[model samples]
Target: MTSPHDAWLAEAVDAARECAHDESPASLEGAATRLRIHASLERRRGSSKRRLTVISAIVASMFGSTAFAYFTGWRPFAPATEPARPTAAPAIEHEAPPRARTGPGPSVPVEPPPLAPAAPPGEPAPPVLAAPPAAAPPRATVGPPARRPRVLPEPAVRAAAPLSPATTPAPGPDAELAAYQQAHDAHFKGGDPAAALAAWDRYLAQYPSGELAPEARYDRALVLVKLARWSEARAALAPFASAPVGAYRQREAARILAAIRDR
Candidate 1:
């Protein structure tokens, strides 16, 4: 079955392929040889670079350790013997501050001028006027009770209640005083002057020298005015009007007395 021409063509093709393979510079053996040469050059170069890096690292580490030791005073090159400390420079003697003149100072001590003799003793001192009595009042009297106004006086000086022996024992002075206030409100606020007057009289009888005595006496005088007892009212108000000048009751008593006199 083989043709002669086909066999010749096939042979020619095979020969061409063999010639191309032999002429190519990149054969497997040549490629291997190049790779080996490049690898050796890289090895040589890498070793030199590694040596340079190690030297640089050694230099850096030495420098850092030297700096650390120097700063920490661990390896300082200070001398063993101590250096002499310089002394302070001797002070030059400048001329003493110019002295104040040796003569007397600016101001001389002097005795105060003699005081003028006190004015010759004045004529014998005049006698001093006697002081007025502390509780003195101007002489005055109450007018007729019939002429008095119908209106009742204020309770400023009204009397407190009578403290009866029959009363229960109170816890303290406050309770006792409250009881007295209750009685006062009963008679005084009830609008009965007569009953109020009687209640006040009983209170005064029980506590003649009580804390409310002055007030009771004053209220009694007012009640007397209501009952047309002008003389009794004047007598009752007399003591209060004569109270010391600056006493709390003095001004009020004086005022009431004056009103009575005007009436």
Candidate 2:
């Protein structure tokens, strides 16, 4: 149950909001002023118990109501409007105009031929002919069909991707060391002369002239002697024990050879 004053205030607020859209500066200013007053009144509404505040809010409300009404076209004191001027003939009537056509000033609109009168009662009505279906528009070729992407031949790709078809070369120093270390471990640490022999053979096959080949050859001969493969031992030891190139394990190789020959 809102009071009449609340309803009037609501209408004033609505009128102010409507006036906010007016293109005129005066209406916009009046809307802004009324809105500010409304905001102040809302803020002091709960404080209506204070006499001074209520008096001021009421005065502001009166001013806002007058403003809202005046801006919203509620004018009891508006000046009488003057009579409107008569519409004059067009300016072209005063001047000689250029000829529109060689013959006529303006063409009259043609009326459609009157439809045939309805058939007399009980006679059959004429059949209406329908327009034919429109032809489908031709499909335009936007351009030549998009060229299919060229697929790479698998064989050609394989050929291009691979490096030159050169044979794998000999093992590197690190690989040589790794192979020799494996044989050495099998021989000394595991005490398996047969496994050592296989590892040595693998190392020698891959790295015949590798960095550790001299050492590997000497060790392999000892390993063959341990295995009692006399012929292979003789063949293996003879190369290093006889010449003892670089004196690498020379004494060891010679001692092993003499012992094997004695055996």
Candidate 3:
């Protein structure tokens, strides 16, 4: 069965494969050299398949991730965006501020100069007539309350006799008088009991025996009674009840003291 031609060809092919650098050798049955070449080719093909499998697997993973995101509504973190602001409304064109009145301003109230003290009666009365108050500039408002006429009704006889020190009221319009007045005003006009309390305390501290001290003490007692500080009220009323410090309102103080005692 072994032919010489086939044997010779196989021998040539083996020689070429061993002697040549190129791998394109002729195929032959029962060729020992072909075994090594085939084994090398098989290894290259296996490596290529493995590389393709890895690349396919990577691609499939990326696709799967994309699909999951699309289905699940997952998105990359995006900072919250601010809603667009509405366009500003056109600026209202306000009339420019009224220019300062160019012409002479409204007539300044002309208060007539203060009149001297009225003379005593009987002697020819000096003219008290003030020119009809110059019609008070007809303000676009009610005319100011009638002002005291600058001219006086003729003064009673000569200037009033100078008041003696004893009969004259405590020469005031000073701080002490002002403080006492503020306290009194607080008691009646401010309508705040606590303010009245503070005012009286301040006034008394500065003026324990001032001319208005008795009146101040009496008013303070009344305020204390109103505030339900009956203990202090009773104490304050004690001097008045007992007539100490030239106390006044003894009848009222005594009755109030009796009421307190009964209570």
For model 2, residues 9-94, the per-residue Cα lDDT tens digits are: 88787877678677688887777787787777766764664777779899999999999998898867977899898999777746
Write candidate 1's Cα lDDT for 1-263 as tens digits: 86544654565566556656776655545655655665676678779889999999999999999999988879648778988999999999888786434433345345555554455577565555554445434334544446656887667975877888799653455643553564477456767777777777776666676666666677677777887777777778888888899875778778878878755
Q: Sort the predicted structures by lDDT, highest score first.
A: 3, 2, 1
Q: Between which residue pairs do clashes occur in model 3?
A: 118-155, 119-155, 119-156, 120-155, 120-156, 120-157, 121-156, 121-157
lDDT of 3 by residue, 97-201 (tens): 864443443786777767867778887767766645554444254344687869867866787878887884654548789999999999999989989989999
Cα-based lDDT for every prediction:
0.68, 0.77, 0.80
On the 0 to 100 scale, the lDDT of residue 69 in model 2 is 97
Relative to the true structure, candidate 2 reaches a TM of 0.35
Distance from true position, residue 73, model 3, in Å? 99
Better of 2 and 3 by lDDT: 3
| All models, RMSD in angstroms | 33.9, 36.1, 32.5
Question: Total backbone clashes of model 3?
Answer: 8
Backbone clash count for every predicted candidate, in the order shown: 0, 0, 8
